[model samples]
Target: MKKIAYLLSVMFLFSAFAPAAMAKGVKKEKTELTAEQLVRVGEIESRVAEIKSMDFSEMSKAEKNSVKTELKEMNKEARALNNGVYLSVGAIIVILLIVILLT
Candidate 1:
């Protein structure tokens, strides 16, 4: 009887604490982009799409190289603009894992 009671109490305590621990592990926030950033991202995406739609076979060597460089630069810019959210989500996942492990 005593063992059963102790086991039940322990289970109850775990159930109560588990949710609080998980809650602490997560934080939600809204991300908003400024009008200018939105416009710039849209423009970059459209330009990349335009580049992709071009006929590379008809282009000369120099034109191909220029297109490649331009695409690389635009990709870098897009990554820079979006990396913050990705990094933060990665951090949050790491933190949650740590919390779960510790608990």
Candidate 2:
């Protein structure tokens, strides 16, 4: 009788989880940017790369500060274009792990 009960409980648990496991396999499509937006992001990235490759020693203090501010703004724009998909995926994984462990 104890063996039957354990088998039934295991079956019930598997039934409860099977759908969620299957659902996790469904891929979420990423949003693609329009051509203009893509071009803007590319421009920002290239400009950032150029700034990174510059010789800081050759610049005046004010120029250095301006470059720093430009870099920050470019980074912010780049992230804004990404729409937090990576963050959402990370949060979903963390939540799924928590749920699995708790169960």
Off by over 4 Å in 1: 1-30, 84-103
The list of candidate 2 runs beyond 4 A from truth reads 1-29, 85-103
For 5-102, candidate 2 gives per-residue lDDT tens digits of: 65666676678669979989797789899999999988997898898799999999999999999988987788888877354787677557545644
> For residues 1-103, what per-residue lDDT tens digits would candidate 1 score against the true structure?
8677656656766785698798986876646777998999999989988998999999999999999999999888887777553447876775565455445
Q: Can you give the lDDT of residue 53 in candidate 1?
A: 94
TM-score of 2: 0.53
List clash counts for every candidate, in order.
0, 0
Residue 51 of model 2: what lDDT? 88
* Among all candidates shown, the one with the greatest TM-score: 2
Compared to the true structure, candidate 1 yields what TM-score?
0.52
Model 2 scores a C-alpha lDDT of: 0.80
